[model samples]
Target: MIYQIYPRSFQDSGDDGVGDLRGITARLPYVASLGVGAVWLSPIFTSPMRDFGYDVADYCDIDPLFGTLDDFDALVAEAHRLGLKVMLDYVPNHTSSDHAWFRESLTGKESGKRDWYVWRDPAQDGGVPNNWKSFFGGPAWTLDEASGQYYLHQFLPSQPDLNWRNPAVRAAMFDVLRFWMRRGVDGFRVDVIWLLAEDEDFRDEPVNPDWKPGDVEHASLDHIHTQDQPETHEYIREMRRVLDEFDDRMMVGEIYLPVVKLLPYAGTAEEPMVHLPFNFHLILQGWTAELVRGFADSYDAECRLRHSWPNWVLGNHDQHRFKSRLGADQYRVAQTLLLTLRGTPTVYYGDEIGMTDVDVPADRLVDPAALQQPDSPEAGRDPERTPMQWDATANAGFAPGGATPWLPLADDYPAVNVAAQDGDPASDLNYFRALTRLRAEYPALVGGAYRSLETPGADVFAYERMPEHGGGERVVVLLNFGGEAADVAGLAGGDTLLSSLGDRPERGAALRPHEARILRG
Candidate 1:
């Protein structure tokens, strides 16, 4: 399992009210104790803090807000010593407008690096070159009065899209990968890998008929010309080749597309692309046994058809916390499903302790999205990106010395923190520990085939992990998604190894509401 850590919100070592790399290094032991094999940190690269670390100013250096490069090296060493692979958040689609390359490109049209970023002349009618909109709002194009040309920024104006079609750009990015790989970095969670390439002809995107006002402006038009283009696959393959240069290094692309579109990101068997395309169906779909099981079943089947590996994710820095989405009652059910799924699983930081989205009032709002479109259905992601709740101390022990955190802590941090739950045998933290232990102990879960089992009703999702050689132990997982009890039959003969409620049910006992159980025969 891979654990994602948003460095700015993970832990604060310098008492600076923001998390740093040293803080993460200090917390490596705590992470290792959770049985996760690796830690994927969100961008710690040098940035201007626009969109946080997503708008990277220097690809080869660590941001001063986090720490220095030596601090990063120490973090990698510590994580390696703890047997945890360090995967970085590789934002390749764009660079901060303050990035030297972008700055040089902005100097003049005759500059040597003029083509480093996407630049175009205005449309004949003096409007945006295309019907594309920035994810942050307004047109994707920002005109530079000095150069009299418009540059594209898919997200924010401060984040200028790179011209990946330029060979020099590709070479520079690959060198950046090499620089990190040389430092013993193991893998990457590529950000917006699909956006690496766009339509060469700069065609206008078709309008989305389903879009309505009050929605995020980016969704007003279909992103055909902007995202998931055919050229993007070749770029991914090129990235895959870079990963292959280093032994055992892997990459997982962050693609928001559906399964069919997501499959090709894995590429073919011989020339594989990203090790995992980041299956986000679990996070995007409605929470229900039928819907989740169907997605899992179809996803597994699709991966198998392509001879590619599969993976699952429950929550991330960008989405609302799963606990808030699924409710406290179904917390264990979600944890069980994530750990017992057919493929690799990514556990968001603090989800193990049942952390919910903290309420951020208008006065405290800092997220650009929330600030841009205040009336949108999904207000912003700041609530979900709050500090990690370590203990019941001031600032939840996240920022020591009574320092205020970059984001507010949840109201229930005292009761809903790691320290509080670590000693409680039935607490969510212990439950998560138990699930990870089960995953480690069972070979059936490591490389076994996923078999979707038929449950008695729609309220229950059942599945079995059949052993690889057809001669070892088989693991069965049953999840009750309803609010009432479910008497799942045929599980009585199996040994009840673990239960979400912390008590093994009596042989053949009915499942409690929202309970999940792992059994082996």
Candidate 2:
């Protein structure tokens, strides 16, 4: 299992009231206890904080907000000591306009670094190069008054898209990966890997006919010339080569394309563009069992055809919390579906405690996207990125006394926290612990082949994980998505291995409302 850590919101170790590398080092034991194999930290590099650390100003060093290089080394050493791998987030698509590289590029069009970023002259009517729109909002091009050129920025204006076409830029970025690998980062979670290359010829994107009133403005136009271009595969292959230099290390690309488009990145095991292309379809599938199951099945089949391993994520810093999206009742049920699937499951930090999205008041909004577009729900990621609920302390134990967190603490922290639930068998945190332990202990749940099992009602999604070599206790997982209890009279009678509901009959187990169960026969 992989745990995604958002540095700013994870744990604070200093008076600055921000999560530092030392804070993460202190929590290594806690993470290890959760049975996670590795940690995927969201961008922690030096940045101007416009797009958080995604707008990296320094690719090779730790941001002062997080601590120095020494602190990072200590964290890596400690995580390795605990037998846990470390994965860093690499943002190759863009860099903070403050990055020296971008700064030099702005000096003049004749500068050696001028071609390092995507820049073009404005159209005849002094408009943007094309109709391409930024994923965050507005046109993707930012007018650089100094150079009389508009620079492409797929996200925020402070983040200018890097031109991968420049060989010098490619070499420099690869060097960044090498620097981290040398510092002992086991792998990388490349952000927006598909956006690395855009159509060579600047062109207007087709208007999206499916645009709706509440959808983000970017959805109004197809990213035909702005994303998932063919050239991106070549750069991905280049990245794969860098990772292959290290032993047993893997990379997961953040590509939000369809199954067919995503499979190409997971080249054959012998030659992979990325070890795992993140599968966010589950989140996009909403809370429907049938829809979620269908997406999982199709993705598994497609990955098998490509001969690559798969992975799943329920929530991330960008999206709404899983519990908020799926409803509180289905919290444990959601965990069951994610962990039981035949793939490497990723659990966002604090998800084990059934954390729901905390609405961030307008006065407290720090997200640049939300500030730009007040009405868009997707703008503010802060709601789901509140401080980690560690205990019932004044700051939820995220910060020391008298130190306020960078973001507001969730109101439920007093009742829901790792300290309160770690030892409680009835807590969602404990249930997740049990599930992760089971995943490690049983081959039937880890690397087994997934086979769908028929359930009595539409509210339940049932599947059995069979041992790859056969002859193990075939583990069956049943998750009830409905409001009413599901009677196991329709399911096979087996010994109760684990259940979301604290208690159940020895036989003929009836799953309580929104319950999840693992039975081995």
Candidate 3:
């Protein structure tokens, strides 16, 4: 399993109300104890905090709010000493308007770095170059009068998309990759990798026939030219080549396309791209047994055909916490399903302790997206980005007694903090620990092949994972999504390895509401 750490909310050793690299280093042991293979830190690079760290000003430096390069070095050393790999979030689609390269490129049309970003003359009507809309709810192009052109920014205007088609821009980003790899980072989680390339002709994307008036502004257009363009394959291949140079180094892409479109991101048998394209179905799939099982089975089958390893994510900084999304009742079942499914599993910070989404008070709201559309149902991701609940102390031990955190602490911190859960055998944290340990100890649960098993009820999802060539021990995973008890049929006979409800049931187990079980034979 991999753990995702949102630095700003993880820990604060300096009591500066923000989590830093030293704070992460201090918590390395805590993360290692969870049995995760690697820790993927969300962006902590120097930034103006416009879109948080996604608007990067300098790719090589750690933001002072997150400590310095030396502290990061110490973090890597400590993580490695604890037998854990370290992964850094890499954003290549855009750069902060304050970045030196972007600043220089904006100087004038004749500037040496003018072509580093996507700039184009306005249309005949003197508006944005096209109908493309910014994901943050505005026209995609921002006029820069000094250069008599508009620069493209897929998200916020402050984050101008870099022109990856430009050879010089590509080389500079490659160097950025080298900088972190040299610092002992084992892998990179590339952000918006598919957005790195767009249609060369800059054609306007078609409007979605199904888009309604109330949808997000960007969804009005189908994004045909804005994302998932065919040219991205070459960019992905070249990126793969760069990461391949470093032994045992990994590359994972943040792709939100359909399975068919996403398959290419894994590259062909001969031309390998990202090691993991980030299968987000668990986060996007309907919270039901049939849908969830189909998602796992279909994705697993496709990846096997391509000879690519699969990965799973239940929640992330951008999305709502799974516990909150699926309701507290299904939380344990979700955990079991994620861990037992074949492929790498990524656990979001605070997930181990069963942290739910906290409501951000209107007056204290900090997310730009939330601030933009205050009335929208999915206003912002602030709820999912709350501070980690380490202990039941003041500020959940994330900040000093008097210091206010960058984001407010969750309301349930006192009861659900790591300290409390760590001591409770029935707590979600302990269950996650048991499941992770089982995964590590059994190859059948880790690298083995998976097959969805039929269940007597639609609410119960059951599956088996066994060694490809048969023999040895195998694992059976069952998840009950309904509110009533489930007596699944055809469950393999085995000793129950772990159960979410704190009971070890035998074969053909009767599961409590929203319970999960792992059996080994």
**How many angstroms is residue 171 displaced in model 1 relative to the true structure, after the best TM-score fit?**
0.2
* Clash pairs, model 2 backbone: none
Candidate 1, 1-521: lDDT as tens digits: 89999999999998889999999999999999999999999999999897999999999999999999999999999999999999999999999999999989988999988898999999999877888888888899999988789999999999999999999999999999999999999999999998888899999999999998888888999999999998888888888899898899999899999999999999997878999998888888999999999888888899989988899898998899998998888888998999998899999999989999988988888999889887784859899999999999999999987788989889999899989998898888888899888888888887898898887778999899988788878988999999988877666458799998778787778878999988885
Candidate 1, position 482, lDDT: 93
Model 3 residue 283 distance off true place after TM-score fit, in angstroms: 1.3
Decoy 3 TM-score against native: 0.98
Q: Report the Cα lDDT for residue 360, model 3.
A: 83
Alpha carbon deviation, residue 335, candidate 1 (Å): 0.9
Q: What TM-score, over all chains together, does every model reach?
A: 0.99, 0.98, 0.98
| Model 2: lDDT to the true structure | 0.87
Give the Å error, residue 201, model 3: 2.0
Top candidate on lDDT is: 1
- Residue 493 error for model 2, in Å? 2.0
Estimate the lDDT of model 1. Answer: 0.91
Question: Least lDDT summed over 10 consecutive residues: which range in candidate 1?
Answer: 486-495
lDDT of 1 at 216: 83
Q: Which stretches of candidate 1 lie over 4 Å from their true place?
A: 377-379
